[model samples]
Target: MTLPQALQYLGTAVFAVSAVLAAGRKGLDLLGVLVIALITATGGGTVRDLLLDRTPFWFTDTGYVVTILLSGCATVVLLRWRHPSERVLQIADALGLALFSISGARIAEAAGLPGLIVVVLATITGTFGGVLRDVMCNDIPLLLRPGTIYGTAVIAGATLYVLLQSVGVPRDTAAYAGMVVIAGLRLAAIARNISLPALTIRDTDAD
Candidate 1:
């Protein structure tokens, strides 16, 4: 496979692992874990493909689905035997987000999409799967959470990709750089508990 495609597969595996961890934490059974894992692994790419009017990658190539399923099963078995620390899972999630965000933007750009659309589509492709997984697990989606910074990180990466591309950087190198920046930001945010300012409203007329 090409470098970009390889990165996409790696990202898919990471996200599948995250989903397995989430499902386990929620006390889901094996089947439930597999279901969430599949959704979390492919949901974002599926949406991206639909928006781009292209065949879903998983449908076109069985490798993606096989990787997710095998990884999901392995995760369940491993977690059932012994659970890993929360920090490890968070690290994996951040890496997955970064990789997926860059890959998504690169794919959109390759398809000749505008910069603005590429950025938006990249964010969607990076976060939509997690949102679906969270919803199915009955937790508030991380993208909408006040302190997550998930979507923000994705947007930042996508923006960087566009900027680098506009400057005539090679696509593969630019994508790698964007992913590194995104992953760094996410890890820093987690370590520092960094978050965006929240909008607060007060009722002046309240008695």
Candidate 2:
């Protein structure tokens, strides 16, 4: 597989695993977990393709579906036998977000979109799957939550990818660099408990 394809598979696997874990946390059955995993693995890419007027990649490539299925099944089996730590899931999720964001930007650029549009599309492609998964599970979407740095990491990666490409860097190298930056930043944020400032509500004085 090419670098972009490889990154896509990696991202899909990571998201599938995360979806299985999330579903399991809610006491979902195997079928429910598998369904969520599949959706989480491909929902963003499907949306991206639809918006770009292209056929969904997963629908065209059976390997993508197979990869997610295997990953989700393996995750369920592993979790059933031995529970994985939350840290492991978090790290995997960060890496997946980085890979998806970089690949999304590259795909948008290849489709001849402007840099700003590429970044926005890339962010959507990176995070929307998780958003859907969260909503399905009745939790606040990570992208919209105060404690989550998910969407911020995606935006950073997409912006960096666009900048590097504009500067004439090779596409693969630029994408890889952007992915590394995003994953690193996400991991750091998790480790240090970095969070956006919370909205504060103030009581009005008597008028």
Candidate 3:
């Protein structure tokens, strides 16, 4: 498989495993866990395909479904032996985000989209799945969390991919570089407890 295709499969598996782990935290049954895992694995790419007026990728490739199912089941079995910490979930999620962000940007660029749209689509493809998963789990979506750098990391990676392409960097090299940046930024933030300043609204006294 080409690098982008391989990354897409890897991203899907990582997302599925992470979702399975999260469902365990929620005490979900196997069926519920698989459902969440499937959604988390494919939601972002499905949305991106719709926006691009293409067939949803998983619809075309049964491999994605198989990958999600196998990864989810494997994670369920692994969890039976060793419980995962939230930090583990975060790390898996960061890697999946990095993979999907660059892959999405590459897809958009191949479609002849503008740089802005490529970056936007990349961010959506990186984060929307997690958003859906979190909403289903009754947790605030990481992208919506004011202090998190989740979305920013995706955007930064997507922008870098676009810039590198503009400068005539090879597509594969740019994609790998973008993935590294996204994963590095996210992992660093998680390790350092780094966060964007939260915006607050305050009422002023009427004078």
Candidate 4:
């Protein structure tokens, strides 16, 4: 398979596994695990596709469904056998976000959308799934959380990818570079505890 296609499968699996682990933290049953896994694996892509007016890929791509199911079950088994560090899940999520962002940008570029739309699509693809996952689990969505740099990383990487592609850089090379941009930015933020400054609204006297 081509690099992008391979990343798609691997990213989907990683997301599915991460969702399974998250459900375990909630003491969910088997069905609950599967639901979370499927939602996390497919949510972003569905939104991206809908916004792009394209068919949702998971419906047409059987591999995505299979990977989600197998990865979910396998993750449960692995966690039961031995606990893995939370870092593993974080790294997996980073990789997934990187892959999805680039892929989403490519789709928008191919669809002849404006560069701004491309960036928006990429951010949605990278983050919307995790947002849904967190909401379903009754946790603060990562996109709303401080210190994550989640959507910013995706936007930065996607804008770079679109610019590179616009200048006739190769698709694969641009995509690879885009992934690095996101993963590097996100991991660095996590390591350094960096985040955008929070905004507070205060009432002022009308004097």
Quantify all predictions' global Cα lDDT against the true fold: 0.87, 0.86, 0.89, 0.89
What digit string (tens of lDDT, one per residue) describes model 4 on residues 55-86?
89988879999999998998888877798787
Predicted structure 2: lDDT: 0.86
Candidate 1's C-alpha runs over 4 A off are 1-3, 203-207
lDDT of candidate 3 at residue 12, scale 0 to 100: 91
- Residue ranges of candidate 2 with Cα displaced over 4 Å: 201-207
**Model 1 lDDT per residue over 1-207, tens place:** 897678778888889998888888888888898899999989988899999998998987899989998999887778657887878878888888998777788789889989999999999889999999998888899998988678998898889889987999987788888888889889999999999987787878958
Going through the candidates in the order shown, the clash numbers are: 0, 0, 0, 0
Query: Whose lDDT is higher: candidate 1's or candidate 4's?
Result: 4
Candidate 3: tens digits of C-alpha lDDT, residues 71-128:
8999888877887787877887888899888878888888999999999999989989
TM-score of each: 0.91, 0.91, 0.91, 0.92
Report the error of model 2 at residue 104, Å: 0.8
| Cα error of candidate 2 at position 137, Å | 1.1
Candidate number with the higher TM-score (2 or 3): 2
Stretches > 4 Å off in candidate 3 = 1-3, 85-89, 203-207
lDDT value, candidate 3, whole model: 0.89
